[model samples]
Target: MSDVASQAGRVIDAGAIRAGTSNAPGKTAWRIAWGVALVVFVMLWLFGKPVAGWAFDVPRAWRIPVQRWISDAMKWLVDDASFGLFSFTDLTRFLATLVEVPYRLVLGLLSTGIMDGRGSSAQEILPPLSWLAVIGVVALMGYFAGGRRLAFIVGGCFVFLAVFGQWDSAMVTLASILIAVPIGVVGGLLLGLAAFRWRAVDIALRPLLDLMQTVPVFAYLVPILFLFGFGPTSAIVATIVYALPPMTRISLLALKGVPDEVHELGRMTGCSRRQMTWRILVPSAMPGLMIGVNQVIMLSLNMVIIASMIGAGGLGFDVLAALRRLDIGAGFEAGLAIVALAIALDRLSQAFAARRPEHVAAGAGEKNLLARHPYTVAGLALIVAGGLAGLVAAPLQSYPEALQISTGTLGSDLVSWININFFDQLEAVKNALLLNVLIPVKRFLTSLPWVGVTGLLALAGLRLGGWRLALLVSVLSCLIAFTGQWEKAMITVYLCGISVVIASLVGIPIGVLAAGRERLWKFVELVVDTLQTLPSFVYLMPAVMLFRVGDFTAMIAVVAYAVAPAIRYTAYGLRRVDPQLVEAGVVAGATPWQLLTKIRLKLALPEILLGVNQTVMLALSMLVITALVGTRDLGQEVYIALTKADTGRGLVAGLSVAFIAIIADRLISAGANRIRARLGLPEGEGGHR
Candidate 1:
């Protein structure tokens, strides 16, 4: 108890809390600050821009000359860095070779015959595992993890893969993920364990993880490409970087949340560090570790499309090819394969996370075979059935030629149908929104004098979180302006801002609807999980079909990717609202509407605000990818810089995006804190936020 209390004091800044009666004074101060900000904004709106005339933009002579330096530095590090004793280039090559061994091994098993040429070549690496054999194995494993229903769902996914002739592509993708998930999990656990053992390490890692999560994945892809020289190695390494953060975060949280009593008991028993961790700490943290693995799987799969760009051959490549050719049928088929893989893996991991260990003693087992080895019996039964099916007919043995189906034409046909029947209507709606809403918002944000905008943001930050936040937002805003990327940065911000509003407007209401109903929540979660696990690139396909190639299409893609977290966080917050307060409202003769408004939503505000914060972060992360669909934002600059291998330009644009995310994150976090303070809630009542 004493240890926990001490730790809590250090974790939360008491001076900043203000979660008490003094909140009245804090609220009054905030109101006055807002009033002043409003007046200043009005004055700027009337006369400032006319006088300045885009003078807020840093002159070319004054703009910082950092890009060239960055580019030169990166080139030296990648192509020439050495200590006279050890060459960085050689070391990276060695690592790539090490990664490629397992890559070949997994790819060989799933897509090629093993040792076809005794390691001389990778041609003919495809295996001959019949469809029935694979299906039986999956169904049996699914049954073991969840139950009959899950088995059916998983089995159906395979059937879809085979029927759609996506089996090869799907399995190749799964093979890489099979390798990446373990690497991420192990790496994350080690880092997390180190953080847990040392307080300084934890503090240092916190900001690193935050920045890493915000850095656009596209920003780092080119550097990784240079290091690993493209292929499965580069793709896998990039994925490791992308997926590792969540594991470390989840593991750290689990370590911190470990019961204090467990530690005390370990001490009393004179348990060694290794023993305690292996036998107690890890066992106790199984649920969190399992969740981390689950996330790793989903993230690895999500990287499929990005990985494909670098020659990590899989369904992602097929999807990209289809998209390039505007072959919706082909793209949709490959995308479905990805979706199937994600859902199956997510469900299996989820069920396994909830699995309970059997408690029976070795000598106390039941005599009946079924009771003694239910899972084993089921596995054996599946093998026997698969054998019989394989012998009965070739069609039943593998994805038979006769049974294979293609959606090659369906995509084009659907596109044609939409273009003919719905394109005109959607174009009208799209044009109206572009002309009246999106374009105006972009212009307004871009026209704001950078100097004035900086002041307003700093003022807001000061009102919310004092000097630290003021300095943070001010520095970030100035960096963008001084880099001469202010115009592009504003457009990025405009996209994120609009996306957040739309996401909140749609997500929060759906969340509210699902919060009170278990079945509905489950259904919502299923759809959300599917969307959340897809690569950001996948979203552009549908958006392009609906809105065509433009900034508006990119905005739609951003919203699609960012909205899932909003819905999830809102529902979670509403559900976590104090039941006792709800009961009190009911006892006070409150109606359902009154109960929700006065009790539930009132207390859920902080969580909703945090959700909005996450939505903004996600929107920012998608900017670079959305540029693929055509958008003149910072992402476009990053994309162009990367393609041209201009390290300085890419890194600058990337950092600008990161800066936006951080400012938005901190500001929203401050708003959440203020809300919590006003409501007199503890700084830590937020559950799983």
Candidate 2:
């Protein structure tokens, strides 16, 4: 006995052993408390009692008075007599009047009333200048930023747009995008900077960013349309909401990423905090911030189509109308136009961000005219050429007609073929999947008593993290139940659940396969980038056509959208597994499968869990868009509320979805962290995990 005691003592110090065990009692008590609280909360909610007393009373007591004050402030701001408060409608009207001036000028020059006038009758209203003139402008902008290759690529985009017969709608789309993107970028920058500056502000603002990013774009349209009354302003507002989060996140990330050495240098150089932040930190962060701007532009252009659902006319409206009328050619034409715009904007931003300071030749400043600044001179020359071409083309009626190309009956014909050849088979498959798979799963989730699910979730949270995470998840779940949208929320959760499962099944293997080699991993990463960059709505049409407006379609779309992060983090985790450990396994004569499963895969599990977290997030993000297929969930509620302009209903439903996402996000994050800790993964070593 003495010998055994001595050996045990040598193995681990008594104090250290006791200290390690000390966490158990506290954790047990916390878990007990979490269980009791969740039980009471779920009881109150499921029994149809006033869960509101606990859930909303605190917020209402604080929020109502504050909201009233904001309303009053807004009223005063708009109604100030000296500021033409009585004439508030003029704000919109004045802007409209300004737009009309340009509208008239362009119309007069082209002799086409279609520039501003609305008519159902089709008319060929091609631009006055040749396509070459527009190409020149694109090439000039590209040349200014980079070199000849970029110039040709950029110019080729415009040439493609024109040749495809998308010139007018494309320009209109461009005009709307140019106005919307700058607003989103500036707003996001300010908000992000403010969040970084103040802890309380950041705390308050974080939820808004979360909501803005996760809630379906459909949910936002109602509030914006109500405020702006559905036009360019409404479209711009929705675009801003959709695009701002990335910019804010990027801005915050970039600022936080500024090096300590750079900060020290700034301090030693006698710079004030403000000066240092502006001149040193901001400039250093510019590359990332520029990337954010690029993202904002891309997202804004993407939103243009969704925004059109609220009457914000552009290429989006054209596409939607064409789709509704089953005009496949027209739809594809508009889609191609949107794609062109996306590519052009993406390339332009990338090139501009990459531009560096260049050396000037001796006495080059004296060489003016076309020699000093080639791009500027070239741009001027193109604009002049365009004007002259317009004048020359005005007399020939056949010129404009020849320039205007159409898909004619081609798109409709193709769609008809698809509907006849593929639609029935797709429909049958979709029905089988929905009835056999999705229905059973959704029914099972709905069959669970709210208390049981709540208890399990809280328990899972407690096991994964400590009491804090458990409480957060319990409260979040409880809120969704108390909001009187529990069933709908469950349906949404069910859809998300299936999506995550599907994502994991597909993503993990791909990740493992890709992680085997550096080049293969890079190629997979490129695929992920493409998936994320492509618009969610672009996925929607094919899904709708295949699955035909049901839960099945929504689930499929969610899977496609959410799988990117899973593949990304999984590959990252597996690749990051210790090489030495794998070598050791190899030396032990472990086969490739055994080595991977036992060593690398085990280490990669935590990262794989992180991928699950992202899958949840992406699934939630897809909810609003997926609701277009008419699923009976919180997303549907949001969409309906938007159509009717019901702010309270929309906010409530939107928040419910957001709360659920937050709960899943927190729980999964906690669980992943715990797993990572156990796996001995180094701190801050994993990306998403």
Candidate 3:
């Protein structure tokens, strides 16, 4: 009887242990949080009509008058504000003039001849650099930067620009980028340095940096347009604003990452604070800082198209014109020019960033400059020879129109053929997607009570992170609601959400396949890299050509533009999975499918989630550009405000979009972190296995 009782007690103890292990405290908490949220959501859906009326949408009476207040403040600034001795307009005009000086100089050097007078009386003093000379110099720089391969790529891109009749516009765009990039880099570096030196400044700058980056590019133009008035100056200012944040953030990080040993070395040398920062810290951090420069360059080029709307005329203006007229051929040609320029500059900058200086023996610096830098001398010689030859040959001075090739006719013919033969099929596919997948999802999302959605998202934040994340999520969500942008915000979410889902669906499988095959991954890597280099505006052209302007067209563009990150992140994550774990599974006699499903996929889940988070960010950014193709969401609001020069309205709408992006970014990131923790991974090991 005693033995039987002891056996029963042991069985009960075993059951208790099993229960504790299966339902750990954290797991139980998660279950309770989710269960409560589900019940609340159901109850809200069923019997909360009275609350839903107010909660579904914030009434105008309850909405904040933020727009009016901002508008009034802006008006006051423009009309009456002064900086002691100078009025606001005075300062703005002076700043504009400062920007215009370098811009005009670069524009003259590249695209237009220097002018001696104003208007019709203006006389050309010197012709712009010969197209051949420009190309040769750029090619030489490429050769010096990377080698023959990079030289060919850079030279080929420029030659294409000239041969394809996009030389003038491309140069104009290039000029803007050249000017804006330097300013952005300098200003960002200074700001970063300041922030790094002062902890309080770093803290203060964090949220501002977040807003500067997350806010749609279009939102930038409104205030600049209002303040500086419209022209290339305003556009340059906007580009600077758009490109500055990344450089600043990168610089700060780079400075922080400099080794303590470097600091100690500087101090041992009796270096002053300034000398230590410039000579020791900055040089030690140069590689990371160059990454910031690369970002600034890329971002400056990306802004070219959007900045054109405010009068930074170049390839951007050409593309915008073609887009507006629905001229597919012209748009494609101009878009390709932008791509060519982007790829060339991207490669050149990346090469320079990765380049290391060769060490010189003692007194090697005494060599003549011409002998020491053969590439530079050769580049200069080519430019001089080309310039002198241009004095005799008109063709050398400017590319001949007759020699230029255009694909406009070919593009038109292709479009015509497709429309004539396959229009019905295309329409069928588009309609089926809209009717079956898009419209229903949009309607359901739009129908959800704003309060309920906010609560659910907040609850998600709570489960994934903690109360702090939950509070942040709810506040940002409420900001949209109280701003009277709840409906439009929901529409934006619907579009972005659907686009993300589609991108993930398409990108993940390809990424998975690519991960296991080296050749396939190389091909996928090349494709994604090329796709990423194209500006956001370029994606719209193909989408519009295939599916005219509407929500469908917008979704297609957003998906194409946003899908690259998903593929990249997934492949990267899968590649980072522990090979030993795979070996162990194989040793256990697991089949290929079982190894992938139960081992690789499980371990890579956190990384895949991060990829999705990146996908969400890219989707939101592209969705703003989709506004050009007639989607009515927050992007449209910003667009309308831009047209009207309504600073407050544009800012309000743009901030709402930023809020949405932030909430999504934070929540998703937290979820990924949670998964990492559960997997027993160390924090901040996102880049490692």
lDDT of each: 0.82, 0.73, 0.87
RMSD of each: 5.7, 7.0, 5.4
Model 1 segments more than 4 A misplaced: 1-32, 41-55, 118-128, 357-398, 517-523, 578-583, 586-593, 687-689
- Determine the backbone clash count of candidate 2: 1
At residue 370, give the lDDT of candidate 1: 87
Record all residue pairs in model 1 with backbone atoms less than 3 Å apart, i.e. clashing. Answer: 111-125, 111-126, 112-125, 112-126, 113-125, 113-126, 329-411
> Largest TM-score belongs to which candidate?
3
Candidate 2, residues 1-689: lDDT per residue as tens digits? 44433322322232432225658797688678777867775665566325444332233333333223433544553455244463654564575555445544443333343343456654545444444565777888887787888888888777677777776666666666766677778888887778777889889987778777767677677666655676665676677778989999888888888889998999899998789878888888888889999999888887878888876676888877765654656776778778777877799899888877578989998897788877788777886777666657662321255666777878557656777898878778878888898999998776555656677787778777778877878887776676566778889889989889988899888998998888998899988977776656656665665556888888888899889988988888888776666666665566888777766777677778888888898788788777778799888888888777776677678878888888887877776666556544564356551
* Cα-based RMSD of candidate 3: 5.4
RMSD of 1: 5.7
Candidate 3 or 1, higher lDDT: 3
Superposition error at 153 for model 3 (Å): 2.0
Q: Provide the global lDDT of candidate 3 against the true structure.
A: 0.87
Least accurate 10 contiguous residues by lDDT in model 2 = 10-19
Model 2, 550: alpha-carbon shift in Å? Answer: 2.2
C-alpha lDDT (0 to 100) for residue 36 of candidate 3: 85
Q: Which ten residues in a row have the lowest lDDT in candidate 3?
A: 8-17
| Residue 292, candidate 2: C-alpha displacement in angstroms | 1.4
